[model samples]
Target: MAISKSQQFFESLWYRKTVWWLWVFWPFHLLLKLIVWLRRSFYRIGIFKSTKLKTPVIVIGNISVGGTGKTPLAIYLIELLTSQGYKPGLISRGYGGHSEHYPLSLTQSTSASESGDEPFLIYRRTKTPVVVDPVRARGAKELEAMGCDIIICDDGLQHYALQRDIEIVVVDGNRQLGNGWLMPFGPLREPKSRLKQADHIIVNGQDMVLEPDPIQAINHHQDAIKEPITAVAAIGNPERFFKTLDGLGYQFKRQSFPDHYQFLKQDFESFSGSILMTEKDAVKCLSFADERFYFLPVSAKLSKPFLQSLMEQIKAITHES
Candidate 1:
């Protein structure tokens, strides 16, 4: 399929230098920035009220428009909280989904088309209570009513309506705050200075080191064919995933689709070799996927000090409440 014009524009903003169109869009970018600033100011000044739930809320998101490993970090937090005997629930804005209802609860059986790919994937992997709504604050309320003590919001850094106790920003190590300009002219949704306000700024794919032989890590039982595979990704930053795979010493052809491109069985009919994909894409392919299809799972590897600091913050919040 041909890339959309919007995609082309975003690419120019992120990867290219000194494009004439950027100057043309500069006025619009400033307007958007001013509007965002005013909206945030309203929330800060109580003109636009923010809902604070009794249950503590932790938001995991990125300032940029594209994916920055937020889902994996949310999953990691869920697992961490679970191990500590805390009941954690998740809430998402269901970016690519449309539901007849306002707040939809997700389960392993929930369709990705209805609950959004990330929310359904989280529900499947963690089996934790997951709720999706355009109004994230309402989603948090639903999760709380379901008996959750802590809520992990998948992506709501700019959703000021939901008052979050802790804000965790996930950044792409390779792309770092591209161009450092907000919106149309660049990739940032908020200014780089916003990073200072975040409780934690986690960089994804930073520690990926080249491995000598990644085939040794694959489970032979799942795949008898030891032939080279094709690495496929339908994500915001495909290059990051591709480079990470290369670091893992995987020999594969690269195939990238537009972010969140819905995959059909026919999409894979042309390729015959084994296929590897990201966990996000794998959630959509489960029905059609065979033994040859494998997804590489990743987790946020925060530093020991960072983890300790987070724990202390959570403890303090709980004590005050």
Candidate 2:
């Protein structure tokens, strides 16, 4: 799942302190800013209109490029809503998936290759209705048709085309806003100021905690994989996953890959011992995984105060509807 050397170099340049080389991408950064501003203006003045769904839509995403624990938060929200007699549905852009169709309603037989990793993993974990489509408004509509009382968008904070009732922006506690620059220059997809407009800002380590569950086997029994393991992650922040494993006192070789990487059987052909990965990566490897493949699952432990505030907002929205 490792990315190319050039990709590695660019990531390092973006997050780390490298001053002189940043000039190379300065022009592109300005252009991206201009485009972002124009898009927002269009949506603001009615030149472009956002599609508002009948059911309330809550978008959970990050302003930064890499993972800020959006999937875990989305899952937590789904569970929270379901416990209160609300039928919640999830919609995602399906970043790595190339489905033959749009607005795909996930079935139990759906594979990660078709519905994307996060959507498939969420559906498997929650047994809730999940839809994948590039146009999130259409996906939201499909969820509404499926009898969902509310919709949870996995990562579409800047997707202005889909009107959202509440926006929850998640930020990595350690990496706050890398270099505070946009796109090629830094990790931000939007400016840091955009966070001011969000309904709530959830910092990964502060507002919510990611508690790792018992590691489970992907293809066999829980005790199948032996010691001398190798943990791999194809997530936005592989180091974070490795750090968590270390904190849990598990010793293993570390392997990192580009985000949303399509894993193959040949990738693990060299490893002699057990292979461990994040639950997101586990979904993609399930098709070709062996007994040696295992995955670590993490659950979001949100603060009670935030939970109370969130439910209050949802109740207000429902009462209005």
On TM-score, the leading prediction is 2
Candidate 1 local lDDT, 1-321, one digit each (tens): 123448655865675564776777688778878888899999999999899999999998888877777887787789888987889999999866778997999865578878877888888879999999998999899999999989998889999999999999988877778777777788878878889999998877553222222221232356334457888888887887888787776788999887777789899989877988877788778677776787777755666777788889987886676
Which stretch of 10 consecutive residues in model 2 shows the poorest summed lDDT? 1-10
Q: Given candidate 2, what's the lDDT at residue 133?
A: 95
- For model 2, state the Cα shift of residue 266 in Å: 0.9
lDDT of each: 0.80, 0.89
* lDDT by residue for model 2 (124-180), tens: 999999999999999999999999999999899989999989999999987778788
On lDDT, the candidate that comes out on top is: 2
Cand. 2 Cα-lDDT: 0.89
Clashing pairs in 2: 1-257
Question: Candidate 2 versus the native: TM-score?
Answer: 0.96
lDDT of 1 at 302: 60
Error of 2 at 126 (Å): 0.4
